[model samples]
Target: MDTYHKFAAFADLDVERFKHFQEEREALSTLKAVEIDTDADTRLTALTADVKAFKTANDNDIKQLKQQINASTKTYQRLSPFYEQRIALLDQSEAVIVQDDDLYDEITRTKTTQLNADRLDDWRNRTMVLHHQLNKAHEQAKLKEEAERAREKALIRRRVALQQRRQQASLKRQRINETKAYRDRFDNLVVRVRNRVDTLDFKVIDAPIEVINAAEAVAAQAFIFTTLKHTDSFTTLQKSLRDTDAKKIATQVQKAATSLWQQLERLPDNQDKVEVLTKINERFDHVPAITIDGATLTQTVTEHLQKTKNAIQAHEQAQTRRYSSPRPF
Candidate 1:
């Protein structure tokens, strides 16, 4: 009963205010007419012509004003959804309400207004402001990404230079080693990989030198064709040799890496997938070193694998906590 009385009081107050607003609005129209006729000393014919011209201009202005308002409303509606989606993508929950929907809604709510020109212009300007802000934010983000890419490229060049220098010092010594020795090393690395998988832990591991060498052996070993069936064959064992088909081998390795990644993606959330993906991604990070594209591949795979591993670890941690927590009373 108290709730009903309160609602009734609110309704009565709204009715009274609406009646008063109507009376004031009508008075404003009368005031406008009185202003137009205030200069009675002027010639009647000229005054009548002036009033007709004013009405013509007002009608034209109202038509253009309404068109602007409608166009602005449409633009705001179209971009509002995109803005919301972008905010969601960026995970910015707080800024989800950019230019509130209510702003646009208020502009579109009424068909009639005493100050239509002022209201329409204000609404249009508000939408333009929001549009400008979105464009500025997008451009700034693009610039930031470009700058990051430039920095990454510089870092990659340094890494490639360091790798090349290391390879040059070892090239002569490596060439003098017996063919049997190279084959033995390659087989040992493959065995190491099998061992790693058999005793796998779910935690992420660094890209070990043995892992990197094994990946290189997959593409560079002379006996790789005999050792691993259904694998690609390269002409030369030494990657530095001109006869080696580095590009073709790189493509094959890339395909294999992508296949492994797809398998990882399809796996259900489990420790087995995490362990498998960690080894696969380590191989991915170092495999392309026998070719010119190694630096690019390493950088790309490093960023991707780090993010993926971090997310998986976080989920695992969360699950552990959830299961281990004490129950409430």
Candidate 2:
């Protein structure tokens, strides 16, 4: 408790009782010196009462100020958690800048003398705004992340489709190339077989009955094989017609060679039979699996023909001599 300064009017007053006359005398004396004419006792009493009222008013003001400071402190305590939570939210967002440190520094450095409800309310409202901004940033970031994920998913699907398309194209190209190669090989085989048939020497035909028939069969086989045309797929053509025709040509040529050898066995040893055999052997040279040694056969046939001619002439002279009369004898 601090004591206030005493009023000058009561400085020399009696301690026991308030003497009105003495106060009046003093006030008058003081007034006379200041050259003022006024009621002494009345003025002194009024002045004293005014001083008392001023002190009372000042005491009331001090008490009301203390009460206001206590109320503000309680309000700040109630709002503190909300303010700190908003600050935490802002820190998490990294998008909102609360600047709480700057505010604290400014207040601390400047020596703020008061804390009030108005300032606390301002802090509360400002924190709410920051919280709202942080929420908006969170929503926007979420939406952006979802959009990016959708874009990535769509890109993956497009890439997969592209890869599948590439694979399909590659497979189609490979099939086309394979088909072309098969066709080329088939055409080449056909051309070769045709040319071989065309060049075959089917000119001479004089031979035994079986030999002639066999030669005719071989000729027919060659004609049919050479004239056969390609059909749908190469595999089908080879399986159904081409392979069959090729086997038939081989069979006929083999049959012809067999028949010719049988006929040669039956025919008498003469130049005519030898010449026919040579021609047959030469024609079959173009056929597969047929070989001929024409030079050796011809040499052998010429010697046999000369020997038979000489034997026939000698027999006819002996018979003529036996049947005629012996004129020379």
Candidate 3:
């Protein structure tokens, strides 16, 4: 009867152990059924730590239960049936734990894959944005380079144009200087001719033949120098000088001829006067026959001298007749 009571107590203890194991298994299933937020990394990491701790604790509990069952089997050989039943329960519990472990591993693998895919997508998006920025920078740099080249070209063109303008201005100044020099030289020549013309001494009428010839040469030169040819190209100043010189020369010739004619008229009515008049008439041939007021200067002087000679000859003949005839006194 004591042995029977001891077996019954052992059975009751086995039943309690089995009930505790069942409770542990049901707790494990409950833990698995609770859904974890996959998007939250902190929650998933905490849940995985908790699952690992629970698995370690369950493994310890299972090992302890097995040790107790072995002790009980050694002490109570008569409780073989109970020991066998507990062994089967332990096996079943082990199987369930293994299945839960496999399911947790699969969940871990799926979460890892999802996290890796999210990381790859993020990397690709960043790469695309970086590439776009690089392209934009490259295009902007190209445009800037082109603008710099165009500015350089425009500056070079402006410099060339400025140089050309300077060269043209220099040429124009040189031409103006040359033209001014030519005009100065031409004016000097005209002034020299005028000075030579002014040197003529037309006041001296009874001068020597050499002096008369010198005067006549001077007059001829003045006439030729002052005359304007049709082929001559003259400026306004040169044309004015020529006309003035010509008028002056004509006036001088007229004055000299008139002075000689007046000198002949003042002479006494004698052969000396007639000889002087003939000498004067001969001198007149060498004078320039310049015309003034439609009358030639030398020709008019000759006519006046001829009239004086004729009067002188008539007076001399009257004096000779008076000397040959009886004295009228």
Candidate 4:
């Protein structure tokens, strides 16, 4: 520390010691919220204030300590030489200072002495109180920390719930897109089948090969769920929460549509594709499987995405039009 601060600390050691001398050592750190106030009052009024300050409690309480072992008396006696030093520094009063002979020889020792005595006590009392306040501050800080921990925990749980909701939303989106792709391919296959039956040259194409190599194109959309790692802490009164969105998806599904447009694409157009497909059509509820080899399901997926976006936007707009309520809390 700097010189002034060091001396100030030395002068204020009583209060510092009091804080450190608390019943609970741990509470000392908590109560550190108390501000350090080192400003002293003017000598005259200050002395009088110290004698009565405890009765008039404001931010800092009055320090009223029973004089123990006459320490002040002993201190004043030892420091009396300093008073003489001050007296020596003052030259005899000249005619310029005093016109009257009687007054010229006189010194206001009584008033000065009383002022000094009172002022001395004021300093002692203030120091005692400063230490007392530091202790109180530490206690208060501990309580504040407890409250903060509780708030932090609640906030973490809220964030986790929001994250889970987003993951669920993303999962649903992937499922819908894949389903749509299958439908689109099925539709295309249906169109080709009708055309081929009408033509005289009847022939079959390999299922997987036809789907991927078809004149029509299909897209692969990737997306999935994740579990995060170590980011949480607990305190005496509560705990801290932490989370990160920096992980990769752990799963995927491939959607391929064939040359025939299998709304269902379940059966590749191989040797037994006709019978297998016939049974599939008889077994399933939807024709997207039969009519289109997975309908160019691309358009369907794009539509679903657009619809979701539109619905979200519509909801936002609706929300904008409505008035919100105040929280009961």
Residue pairs with backbone overlap in model 1? none
**What's the lDDT of the predicted structure labeled candidate 4?**
0.39
How high is each candidate's TM-score?
Answer: 0.23, 0.34, 0.32, 0.25
* RMSD vs true structure, all candidates: 41.4, 15.8, 27.2, 39.4
- Model 2, 46-142: lDDT tens digits are 7677557756765775676567667768766876665554445445533333345654443334322343456545645655676687778889999
Best lDDT goes to which candidate? 2
C-alpha lDDT of all candidate models, in order = 0.52, 0.56, 0.55, 0.39
For model 3, the stretches where C-alpha displacement exceeds 4 angstroms are 1-233, 269-287, 327-329
The total of clashing pairs for model 3 equals 0
Worst-scoring 10-residue span by lDDT in model 1: 221-230
Query: Once model 2 is optimally superposed onto the true structure by TM-score, how far is the C-alpha of residue 222 displaced, in angstroms?
Result: 14
**Residue 75 C-alpha lDDT in model 4:** 59
Clash count, one per candidate: 0, 0, 0, 39
Give the Å error, residue 146, model 4: 5.4
lDDT of 1 by residue, 64-129 (tens): 666766776776676666444433422432242235577545643443322244554565566567
The model with the greatest TM-score is 2
Deviating ranges (above 4 Å) for candidate 2: 1-114, 197-329
- Locate the minimum summed-lDDT window of 10 residues in model 4: 219-228
Q: Across residues 1-329, which tens digit of lDDT does each residue of candidate 4 receive? A: 24345446545764654454443334333433343234222433444554356235422321322232255567568668546543542343232223333332333233334435444444334444544665577778877887888889889888999898889888677556654554454355445544533331112332344532321222111111111122123221111111212121111122323332443244432334443333322322211221132433444333333444565577777777674655466
- Supply candidate 3's per-residue lDDT for 192: 57
Name the lDDT of candidate 2.
0.56
